[model samples]
Target: MKKAVFLDRDGVLNEVLTERVKFVNRPDDLYLLEGAAEAVAELTKAGFDVFIVTNQGGVGLGFMKERDLKKIHGRLEELILEKGGAIREAAYCPHKPKAGCECRKPNPGMLLDLARRHDIDLSASVMAGDHERDIEAGKKAGCKTVFIGEGETSADAKAPSLQAAVKDILQLLAD
Candidate 1:
């Protein structure tokens, strides 16, 4: 029964394109938010298995190719490792928003799968993200939830940024 932290990819791990309000469509568009790597490293050092659960609907909308998304994730992993972090795995929903996909955010499919494969304890796990859908997924998956950024959400906790969120999560784990 290992603990795990599931993170949202876009706003949680990287800077989302604010002007366009969309996912990073290319590797060039990808930018790791400040302190993100260090925060992840801290979580990794805390002994929690880190994972990414995201809804990459851009692939289904033809905004980006699967290979391009892979490239972005590859670079992200490299950056995290460079900062002394370890990501156990990443799972994403490539279907369109209205595709009724089981793996999308707001659904527990991805989290459930990760728990099954990694033998994770859902009760001891945490899900951190910037959107309500992320919180919803976590709740449905039976894990505590952390919401990043300012907003009205049903998350168990809230923070101004991913770094802050991770710190709060660490405290929760300690308790």
Candidate 2:
């Protein structure tokens, strides 16, 4: 079985549009956070299958077209690969927060599907995100969780940022 690392997209892989307090609806709005590419590369090089599990409710809300979302993801993948990182797959839920979607954060549907598709060992995998919902999803999916940021969380571990989180996860894998 393969070990995997699931990551949240917005605050984890890229900067959230805090200025607008909304999602990155346009491809131009997408921006990779500092050190995110390098951190992902390190994890890939360490033999963990890397995947992105995110909630993009903006689509369901009609704020953005699906093609625009694809463009953003394309740019993201290009940037990561250019930086020597590999993303095994990306999964997202387009349902509104109140739509009761199974694949949204705080729900394990996406992670569970990824595990099944990739033959992943949930026990050996890790989920890293910046929100409580991310941790909740990982916990429910039976994977170790790493919270990337401060404040109270139920994650198994916490790191100041994605770069630091990857470092800690690698250390745990070594142990």
Candidate 3:
């Protein structure tokens, strides 16, 4: 089985001054958060396959098209590669919140699917994001969880930024 790190895309990896933009609705609106690329690089270098698991309900709500979201992930991949880090793949739930989809955050579907497809060992993996649902998903998937940003959650660990959370994320492997 392989070790992996499942990361949330929007608030955790890339965003445009989160306070200003709630979501990246346009293909060209994506931007990597400060030190996010490096943080990811460190994880990949540490011998983990990285994957992006996100909830992109705007497509389901008609706010954006599926292709638009694809473009955003494409750009993100380009940017990360430029910084020497690469995401193995990205899987998003293009359904609206509470649409009863299994792939959405707070549910383990996405993580579970990826783990199955990639031969990943969930118990040896870590999931990090800026919301409680991300942690919840990790818990449901049997992976260690790291909470990013602020607010409240029962995450296994918490940090102010993805970069800052690197140590905490790695610690999960030790325990």
Candidate 4:
């Protein structure tokens, strides 16, 4: 089975905006957080297939469109490739908070789908993000979870930044 890394796109990949800004409707708005590219590069070099799992309810809420999301993701892909890393796939839940969709974080649906499609061994994998929901999803999916940010979580690990997480995870993976 293949091991993979699941990442959250917004606060974990880019600076979490103080206020949501139209859901990053254009490629121009898809910015990378400091060290994000390099952190991802490290993970890629460590031999893990990377995937992005994001909650994009803004699209469902009519704040953004699918085409807009595509454009933003396209730029994100370009940037990752430029930094010597690549994401194998990206999946998002476009349902609003009240929509009760299954793919949103804090739920294991998305990870389970990826596991079924990619022959993933969740026990050997890791999920990293800036929120508790991300860790919760990882837990439900049976993977090690890394939480990044202020709140204390029952996550397997915690770090201050994606870069720091990368450093520690690489060492752990090495072992």
Candidate 5:
């Protein structure tokens, strides 16, 4: 089985908006968070296959179209590739919370699907994100989840930034 790194999109890869940006249907609205490119590059160099699992309910809410989300992902991919990193795949939940979708985070549908398709070693893998939901999803998927937020995690590890998290992962993998 192959090890992988699962990442959250918004706060992990790009700036988490103070207010949710509606109609992120455009590449122009998608922007990278600080140190995101460098951190991804380091992760790539560490030989982890990177994947993004995001919850984009804006589509279900009609705030943005699916095509717009695709464009945003394309832009993100382009930027990552430019930085010498590559995202092997990206999956998202487009359903609203009211839809009760299985694919949403806190459910682990997307991560399970990715693991099935990619033959991922869940135990050896890591999930990094800025939200508790992301950590919950990773736990459900049986991956070592890291919370990329302010508080220290009793459930998983926590880091204030992606760069710091990657550094920790690097040291662990090196050992």
Candidate 6:
């Protein structure tokens, strides 16, 4: 069985406009958050399977087209690769928050599917994100959960940022 890491996209992998331009509807709006690429690189170099699972509700809400989302993801991949990080795959749920889709955050569909497809052991995996839904999904998927940023959580661990979260994850993996 292979160990893996599942990461949320918007706030975890790239910048999220908490105060402005929240949707990241355009490719130009996509930017790697501080230390994000390097952290991902470290995770990949450590021999764990890394995947990005996100809920891009903007697509379903008509804020961005599917092609535009593709462009943003392409740019994200390029940036990560430049920093020597490799994302095995990225899966997103293009549904509105109220859509009640199985693939969205707060649901384990994406993680479960990825584990099945990639032959990953959910018990040996970690799911890290900045939202409660991310934690819930991870728990549902049977992986350890790490919550990024400040907030109340039932996550197994918490960190101030994605980079910090990765550091803790690496430490936990080593223990």
Q: State each candidate's clash count.
A: 0, 0, 0, 0, 0, 0
Q: With candidate 5 superimposed using the best TM-score fit, by how many Å does residue 51's alpha carbon deviate from the native?
A: 0.4
Please give, for residues 11-76, the per-residue lDDT of candidate 6 as tens digits.
888878766557688888887889999999999999987899999888999988999988888888
Better of 1 and 5 by lDDT: 1
- 1-175 per-residue lDDT for model 1 (tens digits): 8889999999889988676445688877878888899989999998888999999998999999999999988889999999999888989999999999789989999999999999999888899999999999999999999999996999989998888888789876665
The residue-level lDDT of candidate 5 at 13 comes to 88
lDDT of 3 by residue, 60-138 (tens): 9999999998888988988888888889999999999879989998999999999999999999899998989999999
lDDT of 4 by residue, 56-92 (tens): 8889889889888887888898898899998888888
Per-residue C-alpha lDDT of model 5 across residues 70-161, encoded as one tens digit per residue? 88998999999898988999899999977888899988999999999999988788888888889899889988877887975644677888
RMSD from true fold, candidate 3: 1.3
Q: For residue 78, give model 3's deviation from the true position in Å.
A: 0.6
Please report the TM-score between candidate 1 and the true structure: 0.95
TM-score of each model, in listed order: 0.95, 0.95, 0.95, 0.93, 0.92, 0.95
Model 5 collision count: 0
Q: What is the alpha-carbon lDDT for the whole of candidate 5?
A: 0.84
Task: Assess each prediction's global lDDT (C-alpha) against the native.
Answer: 0.90, 0.89, 0.90, 0.84, 0.84, 0.89
Error of 3 at 34 (Å): 0.4
lDDT of 2 by residue, 120-174 (tens): 9888889999999999999999988899989999988899889988877886555
* lDDT minimum window of 10 residues, candidate 3: 14-23
Worst 10 residues of 5 by lDDT: 16-25
